[model samples]
Target: MSDSEKKALSGLTLDQLVEFATESGLPAFRGKQLHSWIYAKYARTFDEMTDLSLEVRELLKSKATIQLLKLAHLEVSRDGTRKYLFELPDGKFVESVLMSFDDRPSLSACVSSQVGCAVGCTFCATGFLGFKRNLSPQEIVDQVMSVQRESGQRISNIVYMGQGEPLLNVDNVVHSIRTLMASVGIGARHITVSTSGIIAGIRALSREGLQITLALSLHAPDDATRDVIVPINKKFSVAELIDATHEYYEATGRRITVEYVLLAGVTDSPEQARELAELVRNLHCNVNLIPYNPTRAEDGVVTYARPSLDAQHRFRKIAESTGKTVTIRLERGTDINAACGQLHNSYVAGP
Candidate 1:
C-alpha cells in the first residue's frame, strides 16, 4: 500500500483494532497486543512494537501508520504551566495546556476537540477564528500523550476545555474518553467533557453510559445575559439547558460542573451571582468561578479583565449564600496566555 493509503492505528479502540487485525489476516488477540503498545506504552512508531513478530510488524508497516501530532511550538509559564501548539498533518494548528499545582494529582491536561470552534462565544479567543474542522479521536487522545511525554508527569485530570467545544464533536470526544479510560488508565471520574450549552450533545452524552463528568460553561445567570456571552444559549436557552443537564444527572447519577467565567463588570456582579445561584440551585452541580483571561476585543482593543478581588469575593459570597457549592478556580498560565478563553493559535493570528 502507498503511504497515502495507510491507516492510522493510534486512534482505534481495542474492538476496532481487533477488527482491523482480523481483516489483515491476523488473529484477534493481536489487536489487544497492538492496543497495549500504542496506548499503554505510548509507542510513537510502528517499529517500537518489539513484542510482535517481525513478519507481522513488517506487514503493519506497509498497511498502517502510528501517526502522532507534530509539536510545533511550546511555551512554559513561570508558574509551571505549559502550553503547546501542534501542527496537524493538514497544516492546521490546535492548542493544549498543561497546568501544575501543589496538590497530589496536580497536573491537568486541557485538550482541544477541534481545530477551531463554530460556537463563537464572544469572550473566547478560539471562537473568533471560526470553525475549521473536528479533530479525529486519535488527535484528541494524542494531546494527552504529548503532554505526558513533554511534562514527564502523569496528567491526573483531562479537560475537554481548550480550543473547541467537545460536544460539537461528540463522537470523537466520546471515543477519546473511552480510550483515555481503557488505554491511558485514567479513571472516568477524572475526565471532564465541557460544553457551552449544546443541548443535543448533552442529551447524547447522557446515553453514552460512561462515568466521565460533564461540565456546562454556564457563564451567565440568565438567558438574556447568556445569550450575549455564550451565543449557543440563543439556540438552546438556559431553561432548556438546565432541564437537559438535570436529565443527564438523573441518567448518570453524577454531579455536573457549571463553569462561570467572571468577566470584570459583566458576569461578576453580586446580582448576577445571586441569579446564578437561583438558576442552578435545583440541579445536582457545583459551580467553578473562573476569572476572565484577557483577549483581543473585536475592535482590536484589549479590554476584558479579571474581576477585582473584592468583586470576586462578593460574588462568591452571594452564590454560597444560596446553599450551593461554589469554588474559585485560581488563575494559572496567564503569563503564557494559556488561561481560560485566552488560548489562540498564534501561528495563524496575533492576540
Candidate 2:
C-alpha cells in the first residue's frame, strides 16, 4: 500500500468515515466536518483542518492522515500548453495536460484514471501502452488540484481522455466526478467524461442524473474502420453506442460531444464524413475534430503522415455541409507533445 493509503486509516466510504470519527471521541457530525475538509477544502494534511479542535486533530493523527499524490515531472510547451507526469504509489506513472489559450473562454484539464490504457486505439499513444491498474478517486482528484495550485485558476473543466479508457475504471471515475462537482464552485456541467464507447458505463452514468457532458471518442465514421482504430468497437458498435448516447441525453437533457480525431488518408474521407453525418443524424451532439499528433512507433516505425492544412479545411467543410456543427480542434503544445494523442511518450514509444 502507498504511504498515503497506509496513513489513511480513517476509511474510504463516506459512512465508514463518519463511523470512524465517532469512535474517536467525536460526535457524528465530525464525519461531515472531516468530509468537508478532505473534499471541499482539498486538504493535503490533517493539520490543515483548522476548524477542528486540537485534541480532535490529535486523534486523527493517531488513527488517520491525509494523503496526496506527489508531483514527479512536468513538460511546458512553447504554445503555453503543459503536460504533467505524476508517479503513483505503485511506481506506475500517469499524465495530465493543461490546455490554455490566450483568448479562450475556459481551461480544459485532461485527467487520467489509470496508469496505462487497454482501449488500444490505433491513433492514440496511450492505448499502445499496456494496461495498468486503475487510479483511486483521490489520485484522480489530486491531478486537478495540482494544476490549480500551479495556475491559480480553478480548473474550469475536466476531460477524462488523458491516458486510460475511463469506462474501464467507472467507479473511481464517477467517485472523482462526484467529489469534483461538489467542489462548491465547479458545476457538474463543466466536468466532462470522455470514453471509448463503454456502453454499460455510459448508460449507468445517465441514470445518475448527472449533468456532466459525455464526450464520445468517435474516431471513425463506421464500424469497419472504427474497429481497426478503436478496438472497443468490436464489442460495442456505432449503432449500440448511439443507442446508449440517446438514453444518456434523454435522462440528463444535456447534449453529448463527439470527439472525432481526423487522421490523414485514414478515416478523414468525404465518404466517411457523409457516413458520420448520417450516424448522428438524430442525436444531440457536436463534433470536435482533433488532428493526429505524430509520435514514434512501437517497432521503430513512423507511418503516420500529418494531414495538410488544405485537407483539414476540406474535411471541416464536409462536416459543416452535413448540417452538424463542427469545430476543428487546434493543437495546443506541439513542442511539448501536449496535444491529444501526444500525452504518452515514454510508454507508447512509437508514432
Candidate 3:
C-alpha cells in the first residue's frame, strides 16, 4: 500500500500514536511532538516538524504523511461566510462551510464527511454530486483545521451537516466524533450531527451512548410526501425515525434536533406545519426550520424557486399553536454559494 493507503496517522489515538512511535525505535514521548505537529502546529508536511530528530523524521517520512486535505476552491460570501471545496488526495472533492455568527460565548464550524451525498435530499446541492467515498477521521479533522488555518478563529462548536449524509459513514463518523471529544478537546455536548434518518446508524449511535447531538432532516410531515422529499423515508418511515430518535434519547438522555427544510409550496404550508408540530410532540425533540436554498435539480431545472418569508411565519405559528417550541435557522452565505446545496464545487470551477 502507498503511504496514503498506509496507517492513517490522523486517526490514531494519542496512546496509539505513542505506541506506533515506540515500536518504530523512537522514544514514546516523541508521540507528543507528533500530536503537537498534527494538532497544535497543523504542519502540512512531516518535514516541516522542526522538533523531531532528522533520523526519526526520515523514518516516519518513509511511512506516512502529515497531510490529509488541501483547499481546491474557497469562495467568501459577501456576508463573510466562506465555503471551501477541499480535494482529497484521491481526487474526490468535498465541501465545508465556515459561518461567522455574532459571538454567543462560543464559535462553530460545520464540516462534511463525504464528497457527494447518496441521501439525495430533494433540496441539497451536495446530493447533486452523489456519493464518492467516506472521509477518514483524519480527513474529517483536517477540515476543521483548515478552517482554523484560514480564519484564525478557533472553532468552539462543531456541526456535521455540511456535505454528505454523516451517519451513513458510521465508523469514520464515530471516530471523528471521538477524536473531537477526546483528542480535539471539544466537549461531546458541543457537537451536533445531522442525518437523513438512517435507522441502523441511529441504533448504532444509541448503543454507543455518545452525547453528541443528532439532527434529523425531516422535510415533510407524512410518509407519502417524505418519501418524495427525503427518499430514505421510504425505507425508514416517519414512525421508525421517531422511534429511533426516542431510542437515542433513552440511551443518551439528550434531545434530538429535527431539521425541517421548507420548500415553497410543500413543507412550508400551515397544514404541513401543524402535522410536523404534532408529529414531534410525541417525541423528545425540537424543530429547526430551514428555508430551502435555491439550486438546480439534477435535471438542470431550478428547484426552490422563491424564498418563503410568508410561509415561514405561518409555519412557526402552526408549531407554536401546537405548543411546540420552534426556531428558524437563519440563512447565510448566499453571495458565494454558501447556502445549502449551492456549493456546486464543479461550478466553483478553475480558481
Candidate 4:
C-alpha cells in the first residue's frame, strides 16, 4: 500500500497503538514504547525510533506512516510569532500559528481543521479561498506536532481558530482532541475550539463531556448585522446561537468565550457594543474583541478595515460597562499576514 493508504499511527489512541503492535506479531510493550516516541518525543520518522529493533522498525514502516504534513514555508514575525504553511500529502495547503505571550511564559498554537472554509464569513479571508475538504484527525494533530517540533517550545495551549470552521468537521475535530489529551499530554482545559456559530455542532460538542473551552465567533450582536458578515448566523440566528452557548455552558460547567471582531465601521460601533453587552448579559462568558486584520481586497469581496485605536477603546468601554469580563485581543503576526482573519493561503496563490 502507498504511504497515504497506510494507517496513520499519529491519530490513534494508546490502546489502538498497542493493538497495532500485538497484531503485527510484536510484543504489547512495544506499543508503549511507540507511544512515548511518537508523541512524547515528537518522532517524525521510523528512523527516529532508535530504541526499537531495526527489524521491528522496518516492519512497522511498511504498515504505518507517522508524518503527514510537509513544511512548505515558514514566516517568523518580528514579535516571535511563527506562521507555518504546510503542504498536505494531497498538495492542499493549511496554515498554523505559534504565538508567545509577554505576560505569560506559555506558548499557544493555532491550528486549522480544514484546508479552506465553507462558512463564507465575509470578514474572514479563509472563506474567500472557498472550501476544499475536511482534514483528518491525524492531519489536525500533526499541525500541533509540526509547530511544536519547529519551535522547540512546548505548546501550552491549542486553539482551533485557523483556516476553517472547526465544528463543520466535528467528528474528526473531537477525535483529534481526545488524542491530543491522551497522547500528547495536553490537558483538555488548555485546548479550545472556536466555531462560527454552528448550533448543531455546538450541541454535539457539549454532549462529549470534554472540559475544553468553546469559543463562539459572534462578530456581530444582532442577526441583521451578523447575517452580512458571518453568513452562518443567517441559518442559526444570533438568538439561537446564544441559546446553544448557554446549553454548552450548562452541560460542561465551563465559561464560554464570545469572540467579536472589531470591524472599523461595520461591527465596532458604540451602539453595537451596548447591544453586545445586553446580548450576553446573562450568559456565563468572557468577551474577546479582535480588532480586524486587513485582508487584500478582491473584486466582489467587501473591503474591511481595522477599527481605529480610539474606536476599539470606545467599544471596549461600552462592553465593559455591563460588568462582564472584556479584553481586546493582542494582535500578533500581522506584518506577515498571520494574524486573525488574515490566513487565506496567500503564500501558495498570490492575492
Q: Considering every candidate listed, which one attains the maximal lDDT?
A: 4
Compared with the true structure, the alpha-carbon lDDT of candidate 4 equals: 0.88
Clashes of 3: 1
lDDT ranking, best first: 4, 1, 3, 2
- Candidate 3 lDDT over 67-147, as tens digits, reads 566677788878677888777878777778888776464667889888778887766667666787888887898788777
Quickly count the clashes in candidate 4.
0
The alpha-carbon lDDT assigned to residue 184 of candidate 1 equals 84
Candidate 4 per-residue lDDT, tens place, 21-84, comes to: 9998999999898889878887888899999889999999999887678788888999999998
Q: Tens digit of lDDT per residue, candidate 1, span 86-108? A: 87767788899998886655678
Model 4, position 246: C-alpha lDDT score = 97
Question: What are the runs in model 3 whose C-alpha is more than 4 Å off?
Answer: 1-11, 45-50, 54-64, 103-105, 297-302, 347-351
**What TM-score does model 4 achieve against the real structure?**
0.94
| Highest TM-score scorer | 4
Cα TM-score of candidate 3: 0.90
Per-model CA lDDT versus the true structure? 0.84, 0.77, 0.78, 0.88
Q: Model 2, stretches more than 4 Å misplaced? A: 1-20, 23-65, 298-303, 339-351
Q: Candidate 1 — worst ten consecutive residues by lDDT sum?
A: 339-348
TM-score of each: 0.90, 0.86, 0.90, 0.94
Error of 1 at 2 (Å): 7.4
